[model samples]
Target: MQQHKVLLLAIASVLLAMVTIQSGASIAKQLFPVIGPEGTTALRVGFSALMLWLVFRPWRHLPKGRNWRAVIVYGLCLGGMNLLFYLAIARIPLGIGVALEFTGPLAVALFSSRRRLDLLWVALALGGILLLLPDMRSVDALDPIGVLFALAAGACWAGYILFGQRAGNLASGGTTVALGMTVAACFLVPIGVFNAGSALLSFEVIPLAIAVAALSSALPYSLEMVALKNLSAQSFSVLMSLEPAIAALAGFILLSELLTFTQWLAILLVMAASLGSTLSTQKKPAAAS
Candidate 1:
């Protein structure tokens, strides 16, 4: 009874987090025309760090010794992931960009698996990527540069996962994230300032930036932490597999972006691969037990 309710709540929290994050990305995209992607990344990451710091007060539990290195690297990965993702979405459809960036985590999951079943998931992911590749014969081919940027962002996401684990072990989840966001802001905010200059300080930009920060980072992170407390990691990863589809819907509703049949199929394949990887990984432990 109580456990069932908790599971339901965790599932809902993860779903809501996906929706909120995608909606935030859509809103962040709106800022690009006004401040450019560089400026938007600055405002989003910088304001996110501020909001996280206020809530977590990570300064009260600072990382000690070698842990600082882990947090720093985690922060760098977070910043690079955001920056590259923004650059990717600026050129490509938001859904496709998200799907591409998702490959990073997918690869991380698949590569770490020693089971033969994992090979099928890897193949599915590769097929999806192949479908997404720029084909000169196709009129609707995606921008190769944008695809590369998204792939790069996915790589950063993988790094974020690797380093974040180490950092998380050193402190509470909130503290690690808060500290990491601060570090991200330290470096990323300057690039935005250099690109957008005084315009970043405009009354109009600040409010929207705050909204972006809250929707994209603060609120979603808090909700995910709630979900994490209740859900097993395998279950969490399975639920997260839905992110690309949610991103597609958000992109369509907010940005009026549409996907072709092929693109939609690609997204589905990637989601399937992600789901398969999670399920297979769970099976391994169960069989051993």
Candidate 2:
């Protein structure tokens, strides 16, 4: 029953994450004509912070203690990770951005890997990135700046993974998420306002922003928590392999973004790396829903 529950959670997290990325990207595009990347990410995370705060009531607790320190770390990474990723998406195709973003967790997994066999997975992951890097005369102008944003996002993502773990450990069953979410929003909300202006305050963007907040932030975390209840850390990481592939497919289905055969192969290689690492590593502690 426990194993089965974990499996269910893992699958649910993958599907939800896919949907979250797809919807968030689509909404960002919609907001593009109006507010731009800074505005879009700001709205999404801003509203997300409100929702999390409402639920967790971070203000009720004093921040002078460990909670404040934990949130500082989590917020710093979360804010940077989101801002960079949004910038990356604004530059490149969503799928490509995600594929590159996977490098963070991949690097972490490989670095901590005990198995000599994991090197093969690293090679495959690197190969995937290589396949995506060649200049295609046929494709639209690629943004070198966007690629830089993605690398920046990748670095932040690694920080997110590491800090999240640290926060979780420090909180010891407390939900520190609200504090982190709130602080990240605080960091970005001002920039979004300056960039988007009163348009950020418009009624038209509200529903879409709410939907995006739920899809991208709320649902993914909830489902991931549920799944962690059942899966080992290694198994969970392996399952995350679907994130890039799903993002790509979501782009195709929702945003009318298409990919070349070479791109598809690149994604496949990354998946193989994730799978190999997951299967070869030892299990993590059971997750809590």
Candidate 3:
């Protein structure tokens, strides 16, 4: 009974993290007209870094030697992922952008697996991507540039996962993430300031930017850590497969972004692929045993 309660709490934590992340994206989108996506990314990352440093004090365990290289690359990937994701969503609907970006991790999973069953997941993901391609004849077609940016963000996400593991091995999760966020802030804050100028410092924008940082990064990261502590990695990965759908629901409710039938189907296909891939990975170990 105690184990069941703990598992339930962990599941809830993961779900809450997804909702918080998508909610942050919805709020951040609101800032685009005021400060642009660049500015918004800057504020989100900058404030996130500040909050993390205060909480984790990662400076105490700085990465050294080759670990520094890993963390640097990890941080660059983290920064690039956020920057491109914001840019993508500025042009596309939040749900679609998230779904497209999810391909990065999905690709990482599929490529690492040699199992024949993985092909099914790959095919499903490919079908979704194909369906998302802009149809000039359709009034609701997605922007090509936005699609490219989202795909690029996904690539960065894959890199983040790969490099993050290396960095995580070198330090505690909190320390690695804190230092990584600091690196991201250092790289992105300048571009934001250049793009938004003094608007970033406006009284009106500050509060919302902080909220974006909290909702998107700080809170979710904390919750994920809790979930990670209590849950098996396979369970966590399977739960995370729900992210695109949660993002879609959040976009619809918070931003009033409506998806066309085909787009909705595409999102489902991607979600299905992600879920299948995660489950397959879990089964692999059991089968080998």
The deviation in Å at residue 287 for candidate 3 is 0.8
Top candidate when judged by TM-score against the true structure: 3
TM-score, candidate number 1: 0.98
Q: Can you give the TM-score per candidate against the true fold?
A: 0.98, 0.88, 0.98
Angstrom error at residue 106, model 1? 1.0
Q: Residue by residue across 1-289, what tens digits does model 2's lDDT show?
A: 9867757767777677667867777667667677888888899999888887666665666356755776688888889988898888887778888888888878887898656688799899999888777475755645778877887888888887888887776553235677777779988999999998889888988788788888888777777777677666666676777788888887787778888888889888988887887766654323311
- Give the 10-residue window scoring lowest on summed lDDT in candidate 3: 59-68
How does residue 155 of candidate 2 score in lDDT? 83
lDDT of 1 by residue, 1-289 (tens): 9999999999999999999999999999999988999999999998899889899998899977877999999999999999999999999999999999999999898889788888899999998998998897877889999999999999999999999999999999999999998899999999999999999999988899989999999999999999999999999999999999999999999999999999999999999999999898888888998
Over the stretch 1-289, how does candidate 3's per-residue lDDT look in tens digits? 9999999999999999999999999999999999999999999999999999999999899977777999899999999999999999999999899999999999999999998899999999999999998988977788999999999999999999999999999999999999998899998999999999999999999999999999999999999989999999889998898898889899999999999889989999999999999998888889988
> Top model by lDDT, which number?
3
Better of 1 and 2 by lDDT: 1
Q: What is the C-alpha lDDT of each candidate?
A: 0.94, 0.78, 0.95
Give RMSD (Å) of candidate 2 vs. truth.
3.7
Report, for all candidates in order, the number of backbone clashes.
Answer: 0, 3, 0
Looking at model 2, the pairs that clash are 6-230, 9-227, 228-287
- Score candidate 3 by lDDT: 0.95
